[model samples]
Target: MALGMLKKKRDSKMSTDQENENEQNGNQQNGNQQNGNGEDKEKQGGGPPKPVGFLDPRMKHVRRSVAGKWLLTTVVLMIFILGVLSIYWACLFHVDQNLSSLVVYVVDFDGQVAPYNTSGVTPLVGPMITDMARSMVASNEPTLGWGPLPPSAFDYDPIKVRQAVYDFDAWAAIIINPNATALLYSAVQNGNTSYDPLGALQLVYIDSRDDTIWYDFMAPFMSSFMTNAQSSIGSAWTRQILQAASTNTTLLSNIAAVPQALSPAIGFSEYNLRPFYPYQVIPAVTVGLIYLIILSFFSFAFYLPVWMQYLKPEGHPPLKFHQLVVVRWCGTILAYLFLSLAYSLISLAFQINFSGGNPVSSSTEVTSTVDGNLNPDAYGKGTFPVYWMLNFVGMIALGLACENVAMVVGQPWTGLWLIFWVITNVSTSFYDITIEPRFYYWGYAWPLHSVVEGSRHILFGLHSRIGLDFGILIAWAAVNTALFPFAFMFMMYKNKHHLHEYWA
Candidate 1:
């Protein structure tokens, strides 16, 4: 009994001490409340994530892991962009130097022992013009391959030279009329006011073939050449007139009769065989076409989920692998068909005269000048359908490659592939491959090149490589089709073998 009582007294004292201790703790906490709060050091969130120093030992493995990923990403991006994307820049290299690929025919019909030159006067104009043109080829400057075709080459027919320009055999033709010297002599002697100097030379080119090349490179150079040649010929002709005037008093009267010829002796009659009339169509062929690839590539992302529903293990039984591949091809193609139509409609909406204008009765009828010169469509009224079908084939050619690459390379890297794809296509397709480096000759076989060429044929009536273009694009689609199953099968293997996980 004594021991139990002692134990009770001690227990009661201990409880009182415990309560006092609790009260003291509460008072201390209330005092701490005055100073923000009685918080442990960790409750402050350890002051956001610190900029870890290079040598800091804490989380060494974690930092190393992050560093490795960053390094990998940096290296991969640099190598991919610099190494792969550099191909585009390389394609454009030495374009100015390689401009000889753009052939410009220089035909001299002036008094060259031709039926064209019945003029008794010696062939001064044609020789002078031909010499001037040929001299350019001998110079150090970069210029078009001035192939001087003899008048006989075109059967001494100036109209045939224009036909050659229309045929796309030559980018341009500088023709000196056979009777140029004869007419000039007559004008000087008779003071014929109707002697238009523009009749002497014909500068024939087609602007619609590749307007950018024409405007940027060819036009400027040709203009400069023509200007220089005019000045040269003008001075030479003045000397010839003075010499003839010195020969006879009658000839001196002729010089006074046609004093106006002393100033503006000659001029070039420029004929743009097929003009790129509407400026609005520029986007359809150029930068806008890049979006075609963008649309086709990202269509996978846009409609992937819907397509994936069929592949899912949930609700319905999954589609067979082969069926899924077929579905992807068919769906992608159908989507492109509609997408391409939508794209083509934008051009039509702006009234890009898809209606076949009056067809040229002869090749000589085509010209840029507005003498009722309609910008005729190559395919007539069927242009829109052909255009839309081209876009469809283009999409298939381009998008299927994207799909195949995406399957092979997978995400994050696929975006890089997109850059590569866009750059190569733009470099080769939008720009003239003829003027580009030989490295880009392979681009002729590329899908976008074919698409662009076909578009130009359909829209601008440049050249009818449509059959060849379509063949190239179809070949691409067929080749991609051949490889489609393998690429998709690889993707399936990755899924089945759990190669890529947690992606959804």
Candidate 2:
């Protein structure tokens, strides 16, 4: 009976101890669950994590890696320094130095099929003009290279001549009229020293689009050439006229005796194709406005995806990557289109006509100084709506290109900013690249260059490469659009595999 009572007591004690241990374990597990919930709430409800300096939390991997930090610093420094140097100092230097290398189109239509006089005297003016250009090169001063066009080029009308200038084949073109020699010879033969009978020397030049650069460095170059040409022509003409006068007493008494009428045989007249709207410097304004649209479009395209990711609510259906891409394209186009439309409206309200035309009629009375042709139908019809629409298309292309760059770099803000700065430097907005060392022309292939060039053509009546410009813009847009999806997928793969963990 004693042994049975002892066994019962021991079993009851063992059962109580086992129950206590189980209860303690259960309580500890509940406490751990509550703590985990608290931590998760802090992470989810508290908003974005704090940034480390200028970098976001997502960029933590790059911040930690030494090589990555070095690369970032170097790139930032390089961009800052290079952009400043290229835009400000290098451009100024190039404009000052490389002007001598430019070619001036010398289309001499003044050549007489036969001698201008009955005395068997050929004018020989063309050789004289060419000799003067060659002499300039020998002098070692910044001089022009005379590029003689074919005789058939003389038959090209005013519109074709303007198109040639727009194509950048010539800094300036001199279309010597048939009157150059014939009229001068008549004055000498008639012994009429009353006024210059040869008429004014017409210089066809495009005006400066900007205040600083002076028409892609055309002003300085043409100015120098004109000075040299005038001097050479005066000296040669004096010698020729005096020689003729010495032979004929009547001609000598009328011209050689009268020193006051010994002025230059040719009066200079400059005819600018892009005349301003009364007084405003609006050609550059158009360029600035277009660039602003591009910048705005880029800002919108770059930030929209990130904003969508962050601002979207929890219950809302998660946007697919493809959906994001579609949104990007549509949003970019709409944003730029609105911007362009707004500018067009403002321009219209102010009567700021980019396309040179009279408000009342499509055609205006314009007298041609070159050929002295008078036509009532001198102007083409103004097309404002077409230009505005094209501006919208161009803006979309620029935005798409910027977005593609952002996707490839995996950082929207930084990538686009750097790209803009670089493009601005390359653009002739600040400096003419023709003046640059080695004549750097890589930027000519860029969309912005095409847009600026095309816009000038639109503003003026030169429709030389309008089709080519739009084609380039569309091609670039397509290339960028195709690149975006691939870049996004590659970036996602890297993130998933933690491949960028070392240096994101």
Candidate 3:
């Protein structure tokens, strides 16, 4: 009985101790939960984590990483490209609508006067004269207006026409000499081979001196006039040929071979006077932009070393020769890609008309038409693959050359900036002068001009007159590629002292 009581007391004591231990553990766990909540609340109140600085351990994975820079560059480039595309769309729409509003002037110099019965001319003469004048004016659609001027209108004065042309009062003027019709008939009758039938009647004169404004006005009007003239000449010759042939079969066949009215064996099939302003102006602007891009890339490339130097005050440990070479080539490639993309986007945005089709969408179409003749679709059906390929290669070569030169200059930032300013000024001045006597001299010496002109030829089949442009571009590339290895060697040789100092 005593042993049983002892056992029950021991068991009761053990159960009480176990319950106390459980309560203590629960209290500790609750305290830990409270601490965790406090920490989380503190973190939320402190706000988002601050960015790691350059020297921070967290930034070890962030600074100068290829992936990070590439991503940043790509995002920026895509935005630029989208902007450019929008610009091109807008430009195309604007041109389509505004093209028709361009003004044109017509000048008639034919001096055939309206006949008068009191002046002893036949009664039919007045009507004939009026009819011819009306017909000449009527040829164009939306017939402007026509009326006779007093004899005083001629006055045989040169000043009137000159003043009118200068004042923009008339787009063109026709000063018809009084004896023009008589002269035409007399020449035809006398078998004078030198007789001009239209006898200055359609003597189309334009103010070629006002290049910018005049060309814009003249292009469409001249295009229309040429079309009309060709039709009229063809019809008249056909009729005269048939009339002559009616008398004799042999004579008709001979006349067909050598038509009396149509002395020329060949006739003009087509002529397109549509001013290619977009084509010309866009390329020029692109050339200027290309120079700016190249110079900027070089400036950046050159600045890289200075930045790295600043980061490592003691002097950077020399990279292995091969590694250095690899870095240089890679940087150059990257710069080229960046600049090319930038240029393309800008051009598209500005709606600068390029002759080639879109490279991305592969949309190539035969858009050019000369007179009424349809030229064979020579352009590629898709984005001009060959052109883009050539352009890429050429552009890379040019970029490499610029990079090498910058390295040689030792202070690329300054050198490139100076070169850019000089080239820009010279190019602007060269274009300003109407007569470019020294075009050959200057164009050959300037690489940018040569590259631009050459690229135009390769892509759009334009401005191939500069003889050595292609050769020069190829030569520049070859020279630069060869120099790249030497440049690496030179940098290694030059930096040997620094390397020795660091290693020592």
Question: Tens-digit lDDT track for model 1 on 1-504?
Answer: 999999999999999999999999998886566334323333465544445577766557778999999999999888988987788778768877988888899998777645545656876778887887789899968888889988789887789988888788988999997777777888888877677788888899988889888898788889998998888888999898888878778877766767656657788988877778777788888888999999889987787678778767797766766677788888878988899889889988987767776555355656442565455676778888888899989999998899889888788888988998999888898788888878788899989988888888888777577889999999999998899878877876776733233223
Q: Stretches of candidate 1 above 4 Å error? A: 1-58, 113-118, 247-249, 358-361, 368-374, 497-504
Question: lDDT tens digits, residues 1-504, model 3?
Answer: 999999999999999999999999987886687454444444667864444456865455556596788898788667755654443233223332233333322222234343321233222212333354466466654322334233345454433543443333444433343444344333333444554434323322322222333454344554564456545544654565467558758655554434433433112222111223344334433445455435544554565574344225475555554555566676666665555655555544554334434222111121243343221211434223333433444566556655655555555244544454345434422231222232324444445555454444433333233357556656766777778866655554555534343322
- Arranged by TM-score with the best first, the candidates are 1, 2, 3
Q: How well does candidate 2 match the true structure in TM-score terms?
A: 0.66
| Alpha carbon lDDT at 60, candidate 2 | 59
RMSD (Cα, Å) for all candidates, in order, is 6.4, 10.0, 16.8
* Of candidates 3 and 2, the better by lDDT: 2
If ranked by lDDT, best first, what sequence of candidates would result? 1, 2, 3
In model 2, the clashing pairs are none
Candidate 3: residue 405 Cα off by (Å): 3.4
The local distance difference test score of model 1 is 0.81
C-alpha positional error of residue 479 in candidate 3 after TM-score superposition, expressed in Å: 0.4
Question: What clash pairs does model 1 have?
Answer: none
CA lDDT of each prediction against the hidden true structure: 0.81, 0.56, 0.44
